[model samples]
Target: MAKNLTTLALASLLTLPLIGCMTTNNVQPIATKPFVIDSETYQSAGKSQRIKFIVLHYTVSDNERSIQLLTKGKVSAHYLIMDNDDDKIYNLVPEGERAWHAGDGGFAGRTILNDTSIGIEIVNKGIQPQYKDALKDSELDYHPYKHFVEFDEVQIKKVAQLVQDIAMRYDISPKNIIGHSDLAPSRKIDPGAKFPWQRLHEEYGIAAWYDEADKQFFMKETQLATPTIPEVKQAFRDYGYQINSTAEWDKASRDVIYAFQLHFRPLKPTGQMDIETYAILKALNKKYAGRDDFY
Candidate 1:
């Protein structure tokens, strides 16, 4: 009887793991609707009106979720660039009709943006933990938007190429192509610092770039040091950036900083001015002023 009891105990223990692996009636896959439209008149901006901006953003969700949420889920974009390992892009919203991306956005002294710009939401998290030295995506399981995101290199290359393609087609000046935070500073922060703006500039030249020398601090000592508020403000203005220049800093200022960091100094984006940022600003300002033949 003792041997029989022991055998039963072992069998019960083995059954626990088998039961764990058993298909539960509760965990079945939910059916996803095939979200599609005729895709008619998607990019039909007329000859009279102009395409002024190419706003960049991160989906903050997995590509699949992004598609579901944006198109089928009411929120949408003129273009949804899902550049994961597969390097795919979907045009969920038509460019001419103003996609629902850039929710409550503004830019260049204007309070409205969707009417003048094309929105592209890339699939990315675009945030880091409070004080961590680096982004640990593997540690992410609880974020509201990161439940399905798995970003990689292919996504980036596709972003640059797609940005270049759209900008060229619409005759949007490189300076006009900006991130979503650039448009609505106080309200949004997607396509955060980890994004490779420099790579886009170097490989595709879609956005602005500074002298590689300006990327490091010591390498650029005499570079645009002590730039006056007027100078900084003017530089931002020339690039068509909006600035409040308030007595007390507000959310709008931080938004522009987020935008600037996404474009230039993406690694440590506190929106605080540093040597590299100053040089890049000065260089960009000078470029717009026709100081450089390239500009």
Candidate 2:
């Protein structure tokens, strides 16, 4: 009996750990005490919304490579839209979790955008694949690789729907919907000039658009004198571009201008300040000022 009791005690002791492990592995919540529920009627004002911006990017490779890189590699996106004929969008990472896209960038006075933005990576080869063949015998030292691949109509439609759904859910402002190049102008340029900003704005209302009337008015009034460098820089800043507001047309300013032009004026992103670019910046600033609801 004594030996049996000792054996029973050892078995119980060993089984206790298994029971603990089983309880720990279970998904349900475990309460240590009987709890009484208390209801609080008042809501606290200390909380704020988690999501604020939506940044768009284009994977510089095919869909398979994009998936491998985004999944196994260091970088990740909340969503990935495959460049197929069908309407399919893959959710690689959950919306509630942060993705490693939009590294070292800011917009609208917000930096480190991964914490506050939902990143969507579209699977599209950014530049022309035939760039080498096209520029084989050119005397030009620099090859202006064509970065204007047309996104498939079906893919774009799916992207528009997904963006609209996310915007509605998070209350993300139209102005806050931006491209990867828009934020990290210095180091990155994906979702380049080819991505249709105007269509998304005009048709889907997912992004802010430059008012045509405002553009026409600016063009009519400023026919003779182009906007000064300082003026143009200020306008870019007012429109939430991360650029220096200086009179000198420096490299930083040029990079930001290039990014802005890629988004607003894709046909001519010369990286040089021109009347048209300045006017567009002014219109964007005027229309979107004090309207971005991020709190």
For this target, which candidate reaches the highest TM-score against the unseen true structure?
Answer: 2
Residue-level lDDT tens digits of model 2 in 91-114: 999999999999997888898899
Estimate candidate 2's alpha-carbon lDDT, on a 0 to 1 scale.
0.82
TM-score to true structure, per model: 0.66, 0.82
Go through the candidates in order and give the clash count of each. Answer: 2, 0
Model 1 over residues 1-295: C-alpha lDDT tens digits?
Answer: 9999999999988767676557786676555665566667576554443567788888777767887888787677888777556645777776778776766756555556677778888877555444232335544211222222334688777777888888878777667677777777666656665666677787778776676543454335535456666566666766667787664335566557556765676655665555666667766665655421121
Candidate 2 TM-score to native: 0.82
